[model samples]
Target: MAKTACDHDVLIVGAGISGIGMAAHLEMMCPGRDYAILEARENLGGTWDLFRYPGIRSDSDMHTLGFVFEPWRHEKSIADGPSILEYLNRIVDERGIRQKISLGTKVVSANWHSDRACWELVVDKGGSRQTITANWLYLGTGYYDYDDPYDAGFDFSAFQGQVVHPQFWPDDLDYTGKNVVVVGSGATAVTLVPSMADKAASVTMLQRTPTWMFSRPAKDALANFLRRILPEETAYKITRWKNVFMQDKSFKTARNKPEKVKQFLHKKIQKALGDHYDPASFTPPYDPWDQRLCLVPDNDLFEAMKRGKAQVVTAHIDSFDATGVKLKDGRHLPADIIVTATGLRLAVAGKITVSQDGTPVDFAQRFYYKGCMFSNLPNLAVVFGYLNASWTLRADINSEYVCKVLNHMDAVGANVAMPYLADDHGLEEEDLFDFSSGYIQRGKHLMPKSATTLPWRLNQDYRVDKKALAEAPIDDGIMRFDHVDQRTQQQLEAAE
Candidate 1:
């Protein structure tokens, strides 16, 4: 077997949690594998580094969100953006992954060459374009669009006040002593309403439709207690598993008994808001887990409402008047600053133009293989995290699985490994993501196709994925492996 000439064995896009996690797995599982992380931004940390909005924090708990290799020592389980960024920076530095990262280098396009069994990547760095080749391409780029956020098509030109989006929050903008109105009722809106309420004269969350809101303490009492009695690694592992189990069970329960979960959530909200609680404002039209539940840490949003510092207005925006937003119900909300915390615009393969032997690869037309690789896509794995649980949980398992595939390829003297999807394959195509979140619904067309069974769809359950991804054989009958020299021979055999 002969190895192809390439710049690196593996080229990972995005220096965020997914990319960093993949590199770490490669180091531990497949030592001496040459790899480089290409980050488009000038800095790393991905979403954490990108979002600097008020009250920017993780909706998910840190015990499960943190990498399995590293233990989260933060007292706050739902950590702030800066704290999460610090955690990521520490991992890169400690693991010597920082040196391998190429900041400001963005992968614009990637083409797979079957003849050489390698990927040619076109990257842009400071307006200069360059090409790099690698035996394997791993996309750790997150699901959302970095350049463009979801546009709700709100006409803010008529409004006299300043309008901003949370995706590209201005660092110098100050809303102190000014009335602020945040649009939409997603996680971002919930987070911003309470955070801005502290300094703003009045903060109002304007929503078209209500979203399921749940409140919990920012700090994990059991996790803190476990840390006091146990070693850091052991305590972290126990807490992580406990959170994973709870998350899975909660999601399942919500799907199974929506009414029960809805009542439980409403009770918590009522307890926090007291007299301020409005069933119409807190209750969503759909079931609990239809979309992600908005996490209100320490009852911050409810506290703000109770204190008269913040309010939740459920109405459709007819238009933005000079004074403020004009509601369809004939109400005008005065606002000095408007923050559009609408939602994210989902993207696939980091919006990179992917091609196979000069033929454009449309992910939506292809099937997702094992939640990592795509059908007929060789030597490539894209990390798409679990929507129901922590993003890192899926990332961790996907990284390990990719490493296993790489090692298996090496053992078999194979240069290319592609999941073959035949025309007559009986796999039924299903929605890639089950969530009815606005972003998911809007971006469904751009996502890869999913089947009804395992290894053909992206499993949202981390517990099931953990076992399957770990124990599943790398050389599954569906995946075709061949050496560089055998490519032509295999193609000829397939043609016949």
Candidate 2:
């Protein structure tokens, strides 16, 4: 026997940045459409609250990362974790979004009933289980797994003073005056190295290969200037466009002129580190933006390296020793603590098992529709941000697009909207995410494929997606709309 909870027009999974933004959009646009947010954690703030590692901050500027409706009034564009969390919480409280949130409720699976034109979700709250139904399901659960970090299968029991992954940093463990060897050269390691440097006796970033890193000011001068002269919303819009255009241009330049971009990056790094910079230690084998660029605000990492508090070592780890990690080159780096900032273990749709009409829905076999929803998946939208730009930029567009979709369905007296790839659509399957990052590569098989053309491909460009998803025709022939009769709804429930 199962208990039934009240149904909602929309059910948002995850109360992170994306979920919060989605709720606000629904409240303002969808008026009477009732919705609820289900967060697995006890509290909200999602990633910002979950990641409590030292020196955690946004890689992108807050101008573009902040919600379009809410301007980030902070001095620092690349904000720290606590400030970001505060911003998220403030939005929830000010908008009364907490009333719609069901905390500590983990949705296990979502099964769609075609006849009923609704979804049946099995959720676990505390020790009891209940069934929740919704007309639309929005997934804001981020791509990575919160519990597990990709450790590269290293055995740490032999010689570990304290092994930690930034994803699951111990609350009480202290690294003061400790000799720490931070593994990997990604954003996390770079952030951890500089942050731990002030306290640690020495911090060494050990990487199999070097990554491209460049510096910018911790504060946004243009955003500040605009705020002082213009109205709050006006300044925010201007700053947001300024950053978005710059980021898109930079990414295009890197893609088109890889050699020039590489040289420019190398020169920038050389200037930052002065004569002490080693080409081999700081230079990446791939071109700029081959993987997402690591951000070093105010040249903090370079300054730390120049100050002799931290260093970068490019070497492959052979194995773990009783005292430290042994390099394949026969060099040993001694450490009192090891932080594996290797990568993340990716999970799709929060690892939920999806079944359509009693058959399992393999996301790998499906194509992404507008990078938000999947083909054949009705009334479902998964929020995945842009790879080349700020995450929220794309998320903002997605929320608005979903609102348009919901409104269109309601206006037509349609109960559901299903996307399908037609045989004549003329689309070649490509990986949804084009990034060469380790986490993406590891989880590529689990993700949905995309077409080569519009409406089917995941347009990572915010401008393109905004026009296609938000402004394009809602009845684009790809999404089929239909109404379910009372008898059909009854039969669908009986089949369950």
Candidate 3:
């Protein structure tokens, strides 16, 4: 048997927000630890590079979305995609992390060798197979599938003018002065309808159900004001904390006082749309936060509607005709172009086949530990951000926690650390995500379960997780640590 060389101290998959942030955290926290990032795409920006549809931008404000080590100085907190990509590039360039990233490399599978105390990865790098090993595996391979999006199951005949999915948007496709129909009620659909309205003859948002929508200023005046008086770091920190606090408070209020939050959000929408607002087209069936609320900076979507350049239609998509979508209510929307702003297909751990000592590690069967690591999983951490807030908010903390875990393991001379879930943990199983988004519902079975108690429970609250991941003792009894026995280590060394 050929020996596989151990490549680095840590191997991070997917060079997106999470991967980049994790690398930076390790550099800062564990100065001498060696790590390399493997990115499937050729570009550095993961989601930002993958998505190129019109008006692609962050739904969450950049203050919280931005990395903790880096301050977002851009005036528009709700920034466009290119700006985000540039920001990510800047981080990589400045930190000298770009040299460590291996592009066009896709991880196929990871096999953990207990005796070796390391993970051997099979990878496809530009069509050639290769192997690399690492003591610790970190997955930043976010939750979305780049190859396929959620198909809404609409049957369309060959009369198509132009059919597109936002995930695979075409560069040369022209919609100028042509009727456009955007399907879905999520953030993508909301962002597209208004953006396409600027040039398209008419833009219509078609949805089977409504999503809660809110509008805020594109620029953060308070953040700018603070920058004028306070130091840059101080101002950014204050604004970031403020946004985090507000988000946490609002989410709690929505969960506890659904009716109140519903009314408050609805009134904002009604006021924006004015007399043109049809409550049925904007009001969601479930309470606020049941699904993520669609945010439009400066009431762009509502403004487009008011200006008669765009409109919202609430009805079921019966099927797609050659020209456009046909409604179940027998309404026909004529369009020269159709944009399926449909949701993403969720793929956990970049769809990599993971196993421990010949036993397959099924994520669905395991429980989430601190929403970052999995129960009974050793020497691995998965960075899955908040479903409710800015993804980076969770990503930042996950990086910090991983660093702490590594430091603790090193101090104790432990080669392996795993979150041990006892049989008698006595925690009730709950759905991985409480959100009512269709995409999540379709793939909920593939997601790992969360417990109802502390440590095991996802919590999903930033404030709570901040302490749990950051301040909590790393040597907590739940996480077991051990080193490979001397005889086994000798055997592995001899084999090598």
Candidate 4:
């Protein structure tokens, strides 16, 4: 049986970056209104808390990832997981948000109560159930959960060596003097394999396909130094804007022209590893960011390989035995530790079981309003970041807009709002993303569409978000709200 324990003004579903940002904004904007964040995990920092693999760091710089209110004091733009987690914890503590956080409470479902115009949420924790009735619900559950990595038909238990999935890396597992095979070619694999190779006798990154490796400065020293002399805000704005532009331009080049991307990526790879690294394995067949692009930490992964600490083997793995992995190409790499850095299942709403009054909407059936909100759901705002920059950059804008929405709703005495799309084109689930990953390709029919490039296509341009959220009128015609007429109000008051 469902249990009713508490009620609040707003019930936030995740305690991650977006969830924290929402709590901070709500408390800052509406001072005393009751609100609470329900976290499924026992800790905070959703993605950072989950992935413990070495070289696990932010792909985007800190300047953009950081909240506008809090200036990241560190000189390093690309921060490690621990540092990022510390910053988030500090934000929560400084804001006195710990009380607002409800740990070990997992929200199973949020059912809308039309009569009360609020949500009756069922939460499970410590083998008991509690129901929270909230006027508003904010979702911060990330796109992926490392705790339960969905099986892609690859049997992992049969592997003989110490199997360490990045989702849950055991600290006690010793890889020293052991042959380790790291599966997958994404950033996690790139980051962990090189670092693991330092201790492991030999490291191999197994891949079913090719990947694009782009060189990046180890740390932006100049960007750091500028923060000291220049105003903190100025330095942040400069670095943030500059990085966004550079990243966009680089991505655009790959999309608009294949030849240029090929030449530049190949040239850099060749220069970094000299003649030892094979160009074939390094060369990506698809365009950059087609699947997820690999970011190199000052070309360290290749350097480790050239130095004979690591190697990249491109092949499909058939199965795993107690001793090692058997490749489809009739090769066996005996390993003591196997790290499956395989990709994750792409989910938009963090598996919260989204529905409306016991009527569940098929994810494939609904059309996207803004990459940020689902059409036809009033007062329900979704958080989805740009595919280009860090997830937080776009999320920051989304949080700000949500605040605007909240304030507007209070002023108008309207508790419901949903951003509706004018033209669905009958195809939101078309093959929008050109990636070939199992998650992307399989879920394409269910994901949002992007027919035109920027602005309308769920693009990740930060400037575009600034214009849309900050500059545009909050009560734009795209979203509708209901207000009682003065005659109806007077009649109700007289009757009362």
Best by lDDT: 1
**lDDT tens digits, residue span 1-95, model 4:** 01112277678888888888888887677677688999988999888888788778887778778776677778677788998999999999999
Q: Report lDDT (Cα) of residue 340, candidate 4.
A: 80
Model 4 per-residue lDDT at 207: 87
Q: Which candidate, 1 or 4, has the higher TM-score?
A: 1
TM-score of every prediction relative to native: 0.97, 0.96, 0.96, 0.90
All predictions: root-mean-square deviation over Cα?
3.1, 2.8, 2.5, 4.3
Candidate 3 least-lDDT 10 residues: 1-10
The CA lDDT at 178 in model 4 is: 93
In candidate 2, what residue range of length 10 has the lowest lDDT sum?
A: 1-10
Score residue 155 of candidate 1 by CA lDDT: 86
The best-first sequence of candidates by TM-score reads 1, 3, 2, 4
lDDT of 2 by residue, 288-337 (tens): 88899999999999999999999999999998877898999999999999
What are the Cα lDDT values of the candidates?
0.92, 0.88, 0.89, 0.75
Better of 1 and 3 by TM-score: 1
* Candidates arranged by lDDT, highest first: 1, 3, 2, 4
lDDT of 1 by residue, 241-293 (tens): 99999999999999999999999999999988899999999989999989999
Candidate 3 steric clashes: 0
Model 4, residue 392: distance off in Å is 0.6
Per-model clash counts, in order, read 0, 1, 0, 4
Model 3 root-mean-square deviation: 2.5
lDDT tens readout by residue for model 3, 1-496: 0122356779999899999999999989989888899999999889999989999999999999999889999999999999999999999999889999999999999988888778989999989999998989999999978888898776667447788999898999899999998988899999999988999999999988999888899999999999999999999999999999999998889999999988888899889989898999988889889999899899999999999999999998777778887788999999898888878888888899999997888999888888788998888988788988999998999899988888888888887889998877778987668888888898888888798876877778888889777667988998998886646577877899
